[model samples]
Target: MNAPQTIIGQSPALSAALDHLSALATIDRPVLVIGERGTGKELGAERLHFLSSRWSEQFIKVNCGAITESLLESELFGHEAGAFTGATKRHIGRFERADGGSLFLDELGTMSLRLQEKLLRLIEYGEFERVGGSSTLKVDVRIIAATNADLRGMANNGQFRWDLLDRLTFDVVRLPPLRERPGDIEELAQHFAVRMSSDLGWSLFPGFTDEAMETLKGCRWPGNVRELKNAVERSLFRWGRDDAAVDEVVVDPFANFAGPFGGDSTAEDLADVSDSPERLSTGLPPRRDWPIDFQQCVTEYAKAILLEALEEASQQQKVAAELLGLSYDQLRGLMRKHDLRTRPPRRVSNPRK
Candidate 1:
């Protein structure tokens, strides 16, 4: 079994969550972890499983929202040969595989009503038959569910099963969002910076400037901890060096778009542009009485951004790719598409005396 990942942060909110999680770990009932996206609900589930008696057994995970209803049913319950067109052989399901262990059901709120009934059966009695098999299989498995949705509201609205919600919420752990736990921002940012630097082959990690730290702490992270990690890593990649510290940090690229358009537009204005159908449908005004090709305009704008990123990186393709949030191959493909090439800077010749 893999060890539980270290949960970072010392805020009162985080400390309260850990206390509840520690108490939940001692019991053998179903556990439900609720939190916003990127707030680390899955980590809480792992902590529960690893701290329980079933630590040595398999810890199977399934993203309930990522699959269709038909596939989810087959995934949770094994399918027999010729089970609904594509089953070639008898396959065991996650429940059977995680027998005497733990099964982590992520995005539990997205589960269909029908599937919720089947899940409730498993919770009530540890018995389920395969898709096309008659044999009823029994398994002693602990279920640790995680979701960003309000399961109680979902149940009240008739979208989710009330009984399943009641069973799964035997011990509930709600992780606080990053904005609420401001104390963790700097620590998590530094942690991400060090890890990113090591991954990028930097000999020394750059430290965040005081101003940059303040900028990070003030922003409202809608994406929470995951967004913070990405922002830190991105800032490090774009502005950091082995010998120098990061002078500034960009928490959000779109947040600082005031300079290009003569300072008339704020970040909120740019964000609200999508809500205007006139802007999206009409695009730019007609030039020389010719219809504007939005696709071509977008392509040219993207190429310009790529060119600027490459130039800023001193013609280093790898560094430029990181700055533009593209993979090496993706950057190369764009370069080829736009006929962009890197060339050495020309040296100036000296004038004769």
Candidate 2:
């Protein structure tokens, strides 16, 4: 079967993952996909569905983490009219909708024990009852479960059902994080850059310099592919001109860094230090430095911290403030003082003919 276009990578790890998915697609058994966030678990699920015999049927995805426990029950199992306080009509659940096809349960680890029991029944007997209905319904669905959490560990601790794990583990596919596949970084970065450029309707797409590419390949991406995609898009968004070549790709070093101390220094920080006068002729700091502007230095430091927090929170000011241990007002005050407002770069207009 052909691979899905959404899965991008030339590394050996990615190839192995695709092979596993393809091999298991021919069989009709439950599959458990293990990987870190942004590691393309959903893509793996999709590939399995499209490559299987039930490709023509619906491929339904339900995020167990996004839905609350109370709602999850009704979401997975259909509800009869007047079943609960909010139920006004009969509802068809994901299992029914995905009957004779595939169902991708993302963040499966977050599912409650009660829901797990119901899912276990579905997998073991192909039968389930609605939240409020008395009749049992059967679905011929191929289950594909994905999670970043350790399922075996959870089972050992009694948080997850071992029976469910056993059923879903008929075939397992583990995806490697981006850090382990360094060779694919450039390819992925370029892919995201081109895609983002097209999305913005720019006449010309900017090309990354050698230095920028090196910077991208060197940094540790904790959030995996999702983080890398966001960083590339943000860099392109901040690229001021369409005609000029992109000299450097801007990546936030502290994007994944949390806790009291900031993560590692970013490429931008190294550049700042390299250009500072504090460095002597030997590229080393002078033992006795000249007097510096204390206020200016404090302002710059605060602005850098603020920017890092904002990047870590994906530009969410409230979350950024929480990360910095400051109130919303205080965060806003710092942003205004440093003129560190976060806004998308204006599109570069085409020159008149």
Candidate whose TM-score is highest: 1
The reply for model 1, stretches above 4 Å from the true place, is 254-353
lDDT of 2 by residue, 1-353 (tens): 34456788889999999999999999999999999999999999999999999898889999999999989998888899989998999999999999988899999999999999999998999999888899989889999999999999999999999999999999899999998898999999989988888888888676887656756775578899999899788878878566766664555544334332233333443343334434212233234455875445544555666776676666766666666655454455456545678754334343111
Error of 1 at 76 (Å): 0.9
Model 1 CA lDDT for position 7: 89
Cα lDDT computed for each candidate against the true fold: 0.79, 0.78
Clashes of each: 0, 0
* Candidate 2 lowest-lDDT run of ten: 277-286
Model 1 weakest 10-residue run by lDDT: 261-270
Once superposed on the true structure, which residue ranges of model 2 sit more than 4 Å away at CA?
1-4, 253-353
* TM-scores, all models, native as reference: 0.74, 0.73
